[model samples]
Target: MPVTEPIRVGRDTKEELRRLKVHPRETYDDVIRRLIDVYRKCQQ
Candidate 1:
């Protein structure tokens, strides 16, 4: 398992995620990791 840290995120992003049903149990770091990975793939 990866070590996770708490991050303060924007309310709009949080609300959007809830609306999209992205499993609220996930840590913010997980969400960031997925987003960054996607961005990295897009850059390739």
Candidate 2:
């Protein structure tokens, strides 16, 4: 398992992440990872 670190975000950013979820049970980690993968692909 990866070591987890806590980070802070504005309430608005948190709401945006919630809206970006594909499913209710998905974790923030999963959403962020998906976004990072998309960004890396675009950069390439």
Candidate 3:
């Protein structure tokens, strides 16, 4: 697996992410992948 650097999110966004249970152990890629799936479904 290609290791990517941590994603820097804005303070407001970081709080929302934490509320959503995305922690340091989770990669931004995981978040983006889920978003993409929902986006693709919406497009369809």
Q: Assess the local accuracy of residue 39 in candidate 3 as a C-alpha lDDT between 0 and 100.
A: 95
Model 2 C-alpha lDDT per residue in residues 1-44, reported as the tens digit of each score? 99999989999999999999999999998899999999999999
TM, every model: 0.57, 0.89, 0.51
Best of the candidates, TM-score: 2
* Superposed model 3: Cα runs more than 4 Å off: 5-7, 22-25
Query: Relative to the true structure, how large is the alpha-carbon lDDT of every model?
Result: 0.71, 0.95, 0.73
Ranking by lDDT: 2, 3, 1
Model 1 clashing residue pairs (backbone): none
Worst 10 residues of 1 by lDDT: 15-24
In model 2, what is the error at residue 18, expressed in angstroms? 0.3
Candidate 3 residue-wise lDDT, 1-44, digit = tens: 79677777899986766565466777556767777888999999
Residue 17 error, candidate 3, Å: 2.1
> Against the correct fold, how does model 2 do in TM-score?
0.89
Poorest lDDT segment (10 consecutive residues) of candidate 2: 26-35
- Models sorted by TM-score, best on top: 2, 1, 3
Shift in Å, residue 37, candidate 1:
0.2
